[model samples]
Target chain A: MHPQLQLLVALQDMTGMIKEVEEKGSELEGMGFKTAGLDDLKRAREELEGQIEPQLMGAFQRLTAKFGRAVVPVVGNHCTGCFAQIPSSFVSKTNAGKLQRCESCGRILYWP
Target chain B: MDIAEVLKNTSPELFLPDLKATDKESALSELVAGLTAGMDIKNPDTILQMLQSRESLGSTAVGPGIAFPHGRTLAVQRLTILMARSTAGVDFDSEDGEPTHLFFVLIAPPQDLGHQYIKSLATLIDTVQEASLREKLMAADDYEAFCAALRGE
Candidate 1:
């Protein structure tokens, strides 16, 4: 269960890293002089993009392992995952894919 | 308009519409119109102008078939949200290279509540990106269907 939650956080950090590498690489390229550092940066960017897919898969796998599904859209006063009362309105709008915040904990709910 | 109020007002009736635009301008226009309509707010052009202003600064397309176009105005009392679905999708010069079909056009009354609006928007996106939700919206037939989709029934 912990792994499931942590996987999401990990995926977020990975995305952040990928973005930072990309921005840095672009900055280096904008300067437009081939250098060893730039080459390393390019390599890093390639590596990060490559990691994205595997990380995404890993995150999903972990979530499914914990919840028996990827993510559950809350249905009417219940956490689809935990079966608890989220606010009535929260349940109402989220099911419709409108404004969704977990009334109980404020996690954005998504329909599976 | 403050960006914060828009996110606060986001609800099912205001959330589900297929964007399916062929390009950015049409997509934004459709999105603004949809959000304004859902919230029952007056003057769609005012909100459209707000979105255009934001676009002038930079494209709101955040890539991966998503665009978060937003603006603020003093004439509004509350935030308004519009959702659009474009099965055909549109080009917003996104880095993700996936034609954008989902847009979260946010219009708000100017206020110090900007940060909360942004935070709520971020939260909304986190929810929207859930596995099949975007696809479900794309599959919807019309505005009514879109509303049903948002209501998650």
Candidate 2:
């Protein structure tokens, strides 16, 4: 993974957890989610955001807002984000450590 | 997702009828090991780190001796829900302050096209919350009987 892609993937994971907690905070309360830790989650998100570049961070926010997720993995010559067949050459580009995105969903792609 | 289908496609190794971890983090480590042993997940250390981070926010152990520790990561290709029962019970910091007996660990790749991750999570939450099902789950002796019990057989 490209260094930036690594950070982006981690940030994406953090963002997903933060969003889920924010969206389902109430439903998760007695279900054993410490709703009190919502602030802690937000703080953790901010911490992750701090380590990422502003441009990439902006792109992540915009993309996740447009789609459900900001980053996805490439699974078997296909972009799992949009289920689109990725050209074989594109896989090489990603493997060469170039930043890549799914042409269909416009979501960032990482070779996980 | 059909539990039976997932189990069949994956392996019965994912089902741990008797868990050996006694604490929250250890139980999660056991589940993560089972996940890797049973499926084609890569980067389990990262998976364990993410799961621990989720637990730091809140204990998933709640409602009638059940714990649902779940996370989304780049490590997996699809949604996976694995079950493990600790006969002696693991202390998962349950909300009701009871020892957690049943564990449902949900792992998903970030690209959940059909939202199966959340939907399956909701279903598991609803299913295990029922006292009747929890009892059946605990009583199941092996993976096959466990699947049957889950399917209400």
Measured over all alpha carbons after superposition, the RMSD of each candidate to the real structure, in angstroms, is 18.0, 3.7
Locate the minimum summed-lDDT window of 10 residues in model 1 chain B.
B1-10
Scored by TM-score, the top model is 2
Cα distance off (Å), candidate 1, residue B61: 1.4
lDDT tens string, model 1, B121-147?
555555565547666767877766654
Compute each candidate's TM-score over C-alphas.
0.47, 0.78
Listed models, DockQ each: 0.02, 0.44
Which regions in candidate 1 have their CA more than 4 angstroms from the true location?
Answer: A1-112, B1-8, B11-16, B39-42, B112-114, B140-153
What is the DockQ (computed on Cα atoms) for candidate 1? 0.02
> Against the true structure, candidate 2 has what lDDT?
0.77
**Residue runs of model 2 more than 4 Å from their true location after superposition:** A1-4, A30-32, A53-68, A80-107, B1-11, B111-114, B129-135
